[model samples]
Target: MGSKLSYYMKILLGIIMSILLYGVVVYAQSDALGHEKWEYVLEDSGDILQIAIPVSAGLITLLKEDYKGTKSLALSYGTTLALSYTFKHITKLKRPEGRNRFDSFPSAHTSSAFSGASFLQRRYGWNYGWPAYLLATIVAVSRTEGPDGYHTVWDVLGGAAMGIGSTYLFTKPYENPKLEFGLSVNRSSRILTIRYIL
Candidate 1:
């Protein structure tokens, strides 16, 4: 039952991502929210998110018995970062109320937080996932908390969707395939085999 529920959640997250991606594309062309949020997102004042995301990822990786959890987290976070940066350049959307507001297509902070938190949540369950997600939410809120011309709410939303969805697709815990390792020990003229699955 638990596994089935998790699978459904993953599917729901994917659908949400698809909707958000489409929405971002359509909204980018309009000036409904202005570009002030973009400026906030780009502000380079030592992003707490940068520090927090990796830490969260590390915790999830460490707490889980399966090394594959670590690998999955790494892949999810890495892909999200790369994609976020690419979108930033490709979209060329500028920050809110900034000269280059049209250049701000994706929110990096949002992407980073979402990716890390999503991985943690799926890998370690609510106990670890809750804090990670809370921090990620803070990162999202920070975009609109100050005068930094980084991103708009819509941009953050789009980024969040991307991060969560990407991780959900790639690192889903319940659906993860099993991996087995074999070890052999020879002692006292006896042969023993040890096998573990992750």
Candidate 2:
């Protein structure tokens, strides 16, 4: 119980720190075009990439017969999406330059992307995880790039916090029963046999 409590406390602390860090970044920089310089062929593909993470995870889970992983991913993704939209509506914050007046407090793309990345990392390990994280970072950065930027740094930070927090809250380690192996020898017939139990 104490460990669980500590885990949640750490997640909360992380969220608070991220928000504070975002505040510092906002205060330290006066330039509104900080992220505008990054323009490339993949810039417009952020949304597609973000959505692909979960879809790919789901497909892989299904193919690999990972029912628990699939369920955990679904729960985490759904909860993150719900929380993000709820905050967006409640805050009613406008996008940069008043492009959109509602649903702008949290960047949904960043949240979703991060949620998928977190899920992959938590379940699979670093090999599959690091690339997902890198992609998620790209999605977050893309949200704030160019003259038509949709989200501010604060919004992206909030989304990231929500994504990481949600995944940590919902996903659990999967445990599989260990296989038992044994060897038996019969003296009468001098026969050897191997036994395996699942």
Candidate 3:
């Protein structure tokens, strides 16, 4: 039941991601809601996703009682942030809007979002990763979108690479303990068995 439920949830996330992708394609074609309003919506959604993705990944591990996974997630995410900020300090690049003095080399929001996406994929599978990657891509685009967009293409790409690299450093694949049925026959007897892992 647990494995089944997890697979179902992954499917749902994939569905939701498809809808979001469709929305982006559709909305980009029309300015019916005006640029400011739609741009704000994208910006706000990106802000939420930057944190929400990693938090959601953590919750999944916690629900499965995977303390090791939780610890690894923290380590990976912390490293991503540390690396991102370190680059920010070292490069001291200005934002597209020139709003900040020097904190725009690698988009932290993109990094955070990608950390979750890559962690889930690397630790679980593509069934969990594909949708996450799509959502993270949206976060990256949002950072470079709108009249007040913050980062550049290079910034988002660098952030994405940083986040993924960190997760790969610490995360491991998770084996699903799905219930399976088996039949065995011996010289004296035949038997049916059910198997699963805790």
Candidate 4:
């Protein structure tokens, strides 16, 4: 019964965080474009990073015989991609450059990178999360540099929220165990650890 309660609490907390993150994303949209003058840089490198890194990571994890880790990574990446594409289509907000008539409400590349980062954090530790997030940040910046205004700051935030939220919601048990819990993120070491009373 305690485990069940813990599960519920974890889910509840995740929900709350999702809501707050969403709120922040919504609030950030107003000034996203005002901060900088737009420029164009077609650094198609994002595609390579997006596909190659995750696949290689996932493959490495699998090679190491970590099925759970592989599954978790796959799920996070797949869900983020689905969410990003769906959101783009649904919102149809249009990029700043007007090249694509899609919604600029959320950034797919950022979300993908975030999902990858979130998965690494959950399985490996914070040591991986920081670099992943830093890479995600670069991906977000790249979008802005492309003159497409393809994304606003809010969009990047939203992408991050989706990336992390989806993982939290899906990876956690439907019900939790009862007891004390702890969470940690190692910025430099790229490690994440969660300890709970069983």
Judged by TM-score, which candidate is best? 3
- Global lDDT of each candidate: 0.65, 0.72, 0.85, 0.60
Off by over 4 Å in 1: 1-46, 63-65, 99-102, 174-198
Model 1, TM vs. native? 0.61
- Return the TM-score for each candidate structure: 0.61, 0.70, 0.78, 0.60
lDDT of 4 at 192: 46
For residues 52-113, what per-residue lDDT tens digits would candidate 3 score against the true structure? 88998898888877788899999999999999999999999988876856789899999999
The sequence of per-residue lDDT tens digits that candidate 2 reaches over residues 10-125 is: 45435534544554455454346553222432345576667976776676567557798899999999999999999998999888856647767799999998998888778765
lDDT of 1: 0.65
Question: How does residue 162 of candidate 1 score in lDDT?
Answer: 82
What is the TM-score ranking, best to worst? 3, 2, 1, 4
- Superposition TM-score, candidate 4 onto the true structure: 0.60
Candidate 2 off by > 4 Å:
1-42, 175-177, 182-198
* Tens digits of lDDT, candidate 1, 79-178: 8888888888788776785664565667888888888878877765874566567667767766655455467888889888889988887786533445
How many angstroms is residue 52 displaced in model 2 relative to the true structure, after the best TM-score fit?
0.6
Q: Against the correct fold, how does model 3 do in TM-score?
A: 0.78
lDDT value for model 2: 0.72
Question: Candidate 4: global Cα-lDDT?
Answer: 0.60
